[model samples]
Target: MIIPFIIIALISLMIHVMEPVKEIVLDRLNGKITYPKTFIDKEHRTIEFDSLHVYRTLTTSGDFAITGKKIFIKDRKFNYTWTLKSNECLEYWSFMVWYMDKNRPLPLGTAFNEYRLQDFERRKAEGFSKPLFPGTFHTPERTPSQHRQRKEIGGW
Candidate 1:
């Protein structure tokens, strides 16, 4: 009886610890899991997604593609197709979750657009124009050390 109780306790402890470990492993593999249901834009503006937009487009090959879009969820480009069939519509969260589960690449164009928009906003905030390019052009005014450090440490 004592042995059974000890096994049960050990199993319970393992179950408790496994969840966090799994999340950590997933975070490392997939980068930080951001809940994009609501997020901030480059201009320090809060972008919220109250509802999802679903649309169907016909490809030149005569196949139909179903796509989903949500404000500030992914990038501004709406070219990522979730399904080839238009039988059912999926909301933003559901589509994103499904895509992640299937280990699909999160829309790269959208991510790139967001990054560009953010950079543009940051430059605007700093009273600059023509965009900052690494190893290409230097700014007239010195950037703060903190900002420079962040630039060096680059992550999405």
Candidate 2:
């Protein structure tokens, strides 16, 4: 009797935990308006980058794509997913726009950085000496001061 009870309890506990896992998995697969999901392996609480720059990258695809999800800036809003093609780069942004729930329209704004796609991170990671937007405007892993000096020197 004791063994049977313990097994039942364990199963119940596992089911309780798995419910959330099931919901999250199903939400992504079934949700119509989901964000792009990135496949980065780093653990972080905040993903930061420039909004204007991200907007520019949205038009062009890099060599690789991250599996990232899109969501609102509001608290605990990792709800939607954006899609990205195979064009990927080392430093890029991928997001999903969830527009299925509310009737309210997304505010008209040139800035799209407000929409954070979960699990998004830099890719094709280069050495510390590598540039961010190499052929474009920014460089990776450079301090603000160093970037300023490079800018003054007209280095790309």
Candidate 1 lDDT, 7-108, residue by residue in tens: 999999976765331110113123234222212222222222222234444334335443432232232243222232333333433444433321222223
RMSD of each: 18.2, 17.9
Off by over 4 Å in 1: 21-156
lDDT score for candidate 1 against the true structure: 0.34
Clashes of 1: 1
Candidate 2 regions with alpha-carbon error over 4 angstroms: 17-98, 101-104, 107-156
Residue-level lDDT tens digits of model 2 in 48-151: 22221122233423855654433222213443233223344322232222221111122233453354111011211111122322233222212366345434
Identify the leading candidate in terms of lDDT: 1
lDDT of 2 at 134: 25
Give the 10-residue window scoring lowest on summed lDDT in candidate 1.
Answer: 20-29
Q: State model 2's lDDT.
A: 0.30
